[model samples]
Target: MKTSLIKLTLPLAAAGLLAACAGGPQPPDWQLEAKGSMDRSVAAYMEGNSRVEMAELERARTQLTRSGRADLLATAELLHCATRVASLVVDEPCTGFEKLRPDATEAQRAYADYLQGKVQPQGIPLLPESQRAAAAGNAGALQGIADPLSKLVAAGVMLQTGKASPEVITQAIDTSSAQGWRRPLLAWLGVQLRRAEQGGDTQAADRLRRRIELTQGISAAARPLTPVTKP
Candidate 1:
């Protein structure tokens, strides 16, 4: 009887060990790599480096696909679409936004809604009540997000809807500029400048234009050097 009991206990212990080994960590290496690439892409976008941003995004897509992280992949695809919109690539229509899975996190969903509204402000009337509510709420909630890109999108949405004062948007842009996020800083300033012009606020428009010019100079100075040919 003792020998039989020992045999049963040893098999159970071995099976438990096998289970532990198979389970491994929660997020595997590919998931981590994909997330890391996504982060890098966002950072690049903030810094006004579109080339690097697109390249890093591609890496993230590949890694996420390999890891079977479908949710994150969908989020990345949405981000790619947002970047294209930000870059004003009007020639190519943004696709795949409608196909994003519904299981995305709240933050992801909010960001996507903000992007959609930005791309098609007229379509806001067609959105579900819940989506409109989320977009409105995210205008304030997204300010607290750690990622600069998310904060910028939130600010943009608020600015478009007249929910955020120009001062608030200016403050957000200033904060990003202080952190060296030149691309987004310039973009937001341009939006404000245009609004001021349309509103006939000459003083505000001039101030914004000067700010835009200064930021453009800084961005040009910070750009990576290209090979020069001797004539």
Candidate 2:
């Protein structure tokens, strides 16, 4: 009976050891924390809450780094950098983006390209050939991008390259404005307004000026006025 008991215990002990080596059934706490934070950050960004998005992204970065999850860490870093770039925050380099996983999703890859193009429109040759071609006013380029923001960026690229027609860019700007994407809408309007002026299209330029003023007024109205405090 004693020998049989020892034999039964030995296999159970080995199995337990193997399970421990496998890192157990549940994920580490930090990984779960990081994933939750990332989801919230993305949600905040989509809702256009820049302050909340940045804060959540910073939390995700910290949690991912603590978890030693390199893939997630890289993704978080890329998102953080991309947000900063979109907000026109100067001096913040897009670090760890080049180290993104080879199998990164299409959205991730597209965003990286957009950032690179924005940073060095005249010199960076990193954007995909197909996207570059799209920037040259090929409607086909728009087909590959499913994300609205990416499509908008692609259209902006076309405008910057002097390859898109006024009608094409105006359509893009209108779409962004309808979606309440104020930043991109304003930026695209500024670009088209400048183009109209340079071409001596006084009528088109005046229309763009009025649109800019109206958009700015709407934005200002949406913002809460700060209360004055007495010293």
Candidate 3:
């Protein structure tokens, strides 16, 4: 039930693609088979699609939301996958961030494996390489790895899915900082965290406070850039 905060602010997939999911209603399958197909389709659609019909995408979104699958990912991940589909379409060679997603489910694992197998011609589910994952592995673990996304996804899927404990979110922000990926995303997460706290999650608020502290540290290390280029 992990959802990435990336889903709420960004399209997850590039704008054109997810909207394309807006087609006529899809055929039904046994719940298991259908869930699998939907997941694959979402991944595939993300691999190579530019435009998505909003209506179709919304329908697909509904389908996923209502599905009875376990370890079901957050809507944000679907959107993220949709963007990947668009990317694969644009640059099939781009296996950019696939490796960072180790927790992605089996078929998703297969797809990553397939991409690597093309080179080795081997069959085990090999993970796509991502410097980000390496970095995460090296850094101190972050507690709330999927706080924003997971909680949101759960809230949508189940009635009692509560906001992440602030402590958890704070740890994730700290981890993200220690590993990089900070930038504006961290700043944004900060605001959202604050709002979330005011909405009755003081823990989320505290994390946001720590995030602000981390961002300040990062800002200090950065040097102002001049237009001049080194020869």
Candidate 4:
């Protein structure tokens, strides 16, 4: 996915691109570095590379700090939080972004609200192209998003908003699976597993359990090996 993809959700992630568009000069090195780190961070997180995600995110944050732009840093933090939400890790608020929200742009604030499922009708147009449809209560528009990650994030936002349908869940699962995004694939599978158990569909529950286990195994195997230390 392009680094600019996140800009669809919020204006902060593409500070470099915005600068370049305003004139003919290339973006400063700091902006390019920050944007690249931010892009890699999200991609790493989606692929379940927790170590790389945190490292890249910190690198982005450091670069943004060097630019003395609190709002840009806030945007980076919000993007991290939003990525977590997309993977179904919804237990936390975007405290990091909130701390610096005063410096954020109106569009950035709107996106923060949208991710929390509290976005107003006026803010619909400010959201990412994929999320705008869901924010407007038009879940059907999710189908029109060509990017799998974008579609999954929109569906995840729908879940947070209590507007998710069975089809939305299935679509999220299929999208994550297609992208080999193990983090979200496992998360959506867990959702299905819970529903199967609650509905007393023993067969379906068992299948989901096995699938989850298999996915977990793949994730474990894919992790970088740690060298053994001599005792």
Candidate 5:
């Protein structure tokens, strides 16, 4: 589901490449490079590859900077923040995008608000297609999003709105698991594990615990360790 504000605004891989092949006017070099880098950055972040995520983000920033389009840069930052929100990292104030807010279009501002749980009725039309119905309080609309990441982001928004039902949580977990996005998979599993424990469903809790342990083990082994010293 290429449903983010950036995705709505940008041409994607197959179509853009085909256009180039057909000798049609292609997207500007900076646009293509920025979009690709940003997409990789989001995917790497979802997969818990922080090193690659930051590297690709920097590449995106470089390309966007070359274009001198602050709005586009702001869109990139919002995309990064939105992915974090979807992964349950909900504390972001989107300062990077906020710094460039004056240059952002109405749709960009609406998306920024949407990520922050400030969805307004007037802003609904401006939001990405996959999220519009969800923003309007229809959780079923999430199921309509074919893209896993888009559904997750929409679910995150529903969570903020006090509407993340059990089914939504399950879908989020399934999507994260299917995508091999360990970060969100762990986050959603933790949510389910807590619920299972609270409900005294020992069987479910045990199963979730083992899954969490397996996922964490894989992530820990792939991640580099940093030592800390006490003063």
Candidate 6:
């Protein structure tokens, strides 16, 4: 099973790409927290029932919309990711994902038109993540499927529990991003490490070392995704 999982990830993960949103003002800190929270809730939603209840999605949508700070651009990106990841969960068919996805906001409508087989006049890359992972099922592939902010959820959760150092954590993110990965990979790295530890795979653990080691002969600096704020 470990080998099976790795095989699935090898081609996809090998590239180590990260997703980036077009430049814009970031949502407020509170919105950031809400968006981050929604992500963890989403994982639980996916891991258990394969889909979240409409109520749950509504709550997330509500939180995201609060403060008059709705980020439709980010929301559409989130839905795009959710739609794609729906294909990955073996337990869940991608049935209602299209409908179940939080309604796309007006700003996101343009994006939807493009996704629904329509072409926008502009040549912007609306499908970076999918384009990056076309032939593989690596996390980088999922980078397109999952919201970049969603990655912060795991890291935030870890940080909240005091399991990691913010400084070292920041370093970990910097190290990976300098290599052409997105900032979110820092958080996903947290999830991946936890997965390896739980599965008790030394080989996988060693793989982390080989993957993270740099020209300096030091292992990739990974700190637990410890959150500084309260839950």
Candidate 6 has an lDDT of 0.35
Which sections of candidate 5 miss by over 4 Å?
A: 1-24, 224-231
lDDT tens digits by residue: candidate 1, 97-139: 4555465444444445556555244444443333344255444
User: What C-alpha lDDT values do all the predictions have?
Assistant: 0.53, 0.52, 0.34, 0.76, 0.76, 0.35
Q: How many clashes in each structure?
A: 0, 0, 21, 0, 1, 7
Residue 103 Cα positional deviation in candidate 5, in Å, after optimal superposition:
1.2
Error of 1 at 207 (Å): 3.0
Where model 4 places Cα greater than 4 Å from the true spot, the runs are 1-7, 10-25, 221-231
The Cα error of candidate 1 at residue 212, in Å, is 1.3
Writing each residue's lDDT as its tens digit, candidate 4 over 1-231 gives 443434454454544543654565887788778778988988888887888999999998898898787767877887788787678877678988888888887777888888788988898887766678888878585788887766877888888777778788889889888887788888888888777878899999899888877787875546632211110
Candidate 1 minimal-lDDT segment of 10 residues: 1-10
Ten contiguous residues minimizing lDDT sum, candidate 6: 1-10
lDDT by residue for model 3 (60-177), tens: 4456456443223333344343333211221333232353345555444443333222222232223222211211232322222243332222211111112234443344335334
Location of the lowest summed lDDT over 10 successive residues in candidate 5: 222-231
lDDT of 2 by residue, 94-201 (tens): 666666646444444554555544424432333444355563456556556544544555565555445556665666677567666555566667767778788899
Across 1-231, the per-residue lDDT of candidate 5 in tens digits comes to: 133334433321123421443467987787677777887888888877889989999998899788676766777888788887778777768888899888877887888888888978999998878889889989597778987777888888887787888899899889988888888888888878888888899999899888887887775546722211100
Query: TM-score for all predictions?
Result: 0.62, 0.56, 0.24, 0.85, 0.85, 0.31
Model 1 segments more than 4 A misplaced: 1-26, 81-99, 102-111, 118-134, 137-147, 221-231
Cα RMSD of all models vs. native, in order, equals 14.3, 15.2, 17.9, 6.2, 5.5, 15.5
